[model samples]
Structure formats: structure tokens, C-alpha cells
Target: MSEPTNLPVDPEPIREILKNHQQQIRLGLRMCAHCGLCADSCFLYRANDRAPEYMPSYKFLNSIGVLFKKKGKVGKPAVEEMGALVFENCVLCTRCYCPFGIDIPALITLGRRACRSQGVFRAYDK
Candidate 1:
């Protein structure tokens, strides 16, 4: 197999989009309290022995939430971390539930899109 490489990213367009699309993103991001109730919704989290980073909230919070908070000025390391969430951690199956009504699946999906737009993706996501 080929080696995994960090995704090449350009933050300018991402920053502009985050600035323009602050409507629902802000509310959606803040809705979660990282309560961990959404853990069961993901097979990866369940099968992985409930690892903290595998939880849906972690993916949502770290990916889109971080981007929103930083106004998309995230460095390469942050983008790589988001890739972990989007690629290896989350498959965007869209089958998620949140007791706190946070809609975790949608948030993760948004994160996936943002990462995709910035060319931050693994060729074969686990």
C-alpha cells in the first residue's frame, strides 16, 4: 500500500465560506455539549471500545466547530486532525442520534464537506 500523506490545503476559500455561512453553523456547533450520548450512534465508536475521539461529538466539535471558532484559519496540523475525523473516524453514514437534539450526523457531514473542499481527504478512508 502507498503511504498516507497530509492533505494539501488552502485556507482562504475555506475562511471566506465560513464567514459567509455562519447562520446555522454557529447554532449547530454550539448545540452540542460533548455529552457523549451520541456514542452509540456510530459503529466505529462502539466497535472501537468507545474511544473518546471516535465519538460523533468529537468529530463534530473538532472538525467544523474548530473551523468555525478559528474562522477557518486553522494550520496544517488542524486540517490533518480534521482529516482523521472525516476520513478514518467518520464515514458520513448519516445514521446518528443525539439525546440533546444536536443532529450530530449533519454536523459531521458538514465537516466532511469542508474537509473535502479544502482537499483534505484520505484516498481510502478507514
Candidate 2:
């Protein structure tokens, strides 16, 4: 609903946020190998006829991982797009079974919480 915010030009705030949540963010990003196993585990993916966007790994990798790569220096529009994956789409089924035993739900929740901290809640989130 807003234009590009041009946020965190200095990188300090992004760096501080990275310091705060570095471990899980890094862990989640590293653990996922994009094998698409978690996609089969997600009910949304199943119900949606295996649509690519409903895949948990796809959502997190594209949204949260992208944010981590950008070091949290995202605009409002970016956060909203991330929210589509992190909040609107995920049901947090805790079924994103990583063969590596990574906690997909936790990582996605972390992203949602980070967005929440930024007052980026979508009206559709229950």
C-alpha cells in the first residue's frame, strides 16, 4: 500500500537487526537445500494442486531468505510482499519436514515476527 521506503541507507539498523537474529536466520537459510520435500509436506501445496507459491521452502527462500540477504534493509512494499509468503500463505502446519531436521515453521514465524516488529501486519492474518 505504500511506495518504496528507501529504508536503512546507513546499514547500521540492518546490521543491528542481523546481530539480533543472526543465528536462526542463518541456520534456516543454510539448512534448506530447495529439495521441495517441504512442498509435499505443506497442506496448502497439496490442496492447491502443488502450486509453487504454496511450497513452504519456496515461500521462505524467496521472502525471508531474500530479506536476510538484503540485510533487513527492506521497504514497506517489500515487507508486504514478504508477508504474502510469511503470513498470508502459511498455516504453520509444522509439517515442513526437512530431512535435515530444520524447523521451517520456526523460521517462517521468525520472519513474521520480524515483520510484526516493523508494524507490517497484513489485515488477513489470523
Candidate 3:
């Protein structure tokens, strides 16, 4: 029920969060073979007719992956876009399967944190 903020992105906290989890994020991003093996494990993917964008790895790549790639220097619009991917698109069901055991939910959670750091999040009506 909270409203999204228009405040600009702050590099310090965002970088700090990324820095704390840099190793994990880097490994997840780099080790992802993009082979689509994890697709079947995602309910979103299966329920959405196996769309590529709904795949667990795809979500990670687009959300947290982008954050790491940009070194947490993304703008408000980028953060808002990530808000959709991480908060709206993902329910954090934690059912995603990865052959490499990439901990997809944790990565998505990181994405949520990154978005919140920029004052972007899901808004609900009361």
C-alpha cells in the first residue's frame, strides 16, 4: 500500500548492497548458461505458455543482472522498470530450479532490495 517515490537514485547505498553480494551476483550471472533448463521449474513460465521473459533465469538476468552490470548506477526509470520485473513479475515463490543451484529467489530478492533503494516498489490500492 506504499507509494513509489520519485527521489533520484543514490549511488552509495545501492553500490553497498551490490558490493555486499557482488560475488554471488557475479557468479549467478556468469554461470548462467542461458540454456533454459530452469524454465520448467518456474510456474510463471509454465503458466504463461513458456514465454522466454517469464523464465526464472531470464528474470534474474533482466533484473538483478542489469543492476550488477550497471554497477548500481541506473536511473529512476531503470529502477521503475526493474520494479515491475522483480516485484510484480516475480512472486518470490522460491520454486525455481537451477542445475547450478543459482539461488534464484535470493537473487530476485536482491533485485527487490535494489529497487527499494531507489524508492521503487509495487503500489497497492487500499
Candidate 4:
């Protein structure tokens, strides 16, 4: 397996990329009701003993939510951290259900895109 490499952080392009998806991010962020109903549907959450961080809403809130809130001005380290949350933590399972009809997988995908712009992504062994 190759080691994960860090690319130099450039805030301008990251801002631009995120700007393009502003609408979806904003809608996803606003759609979550925070009722915690989706938690039980996640295998990771249940396998991990119901940790709050494993919950879909919690993951979205902490990663995508934080990225949008900061307006993509965060550094590489922050991006990497959020990458772990969205990329490593989530598999875009699409099994996570929101009674309010929120699209959790799409939002997580948005978070993945944000992380990719910063060169923070999952490293697979060849």
C-alpha cells in the first residue's frame, strides 16, 4: 500500500469548487431535522455501539456542515480530518433514511468532493 500524500493546500480553488455546489449543500444542511432517527439504520453506528459520530446526521453535520460553515477557508489538516469523516466513515450506503426525505448519500458525496479538492481522500492498496 502506498502512503497517502498531501498536496499543497490552495484555498481559492477549493472555494470555487465548493461554491459550485452551494445550493445542494445548503439544502442538505437545512433539511436534517436532527431527530436522530437515522442512526439506527447505520451498520457502523450499531456495530460501533451506537456512537453518535457514526450517525448520518452527526457525520454530515460535523464534516459537510463544518466545511460549508467555514466557507472552504480551512487548512489541509482540517480537510484531511473531514475526509476521514465523510470518506472513511461513510460508504454512501444510501440505506440511511430520513423521514423528512433528506438525501444523506448525496450530501456525503458533496463532502467527498470537498475533501478531494484538498487532496484528502481514501488511499487504497494497489
My TM-score estimates for the predictions, one after another, are 0.83, 0.79, 0.90, 0.87
1-126 in candidate 4: lDDT tens per residue?
113556666777667766887887788788877899999988888988898878999888777788789877777777777788887778888899888887888778877877776677787864
Tell me the spans in candidate 3 whose CA falls farther than 4 Å from its real position. 1-6
lDDT of each: 0.76, 0.73, 0.85, 0.79
| Of candidates 4 and 3, the better by TM-score | 3
Q: Please name the candidate that would achieve the greatest lDDT relative to the true structure.
A: 3
TM-score: which candidate is best? Answer: 3
Backbone-clash count (model 1): 0
* Clashing pairs in model 3, backbone N/Cα/C closer than 3 A: none
After TM-score superposition, the amount by which residue 16's alpha carbon in candidate 2 deviates from its true location, in angstroms, is 5.1
lDDT of 1 at 32: 73
Candidate order, lDDT descending: 3, 4, 1, 2
Model 1 TM: 0.83
Clash count for candidate 2 is 0
Measured with C-alpha atoms, the lDDT of residue 20 in candidate 1 is 68
| Over 4 Å off, model 2 | 1-17, 124-126
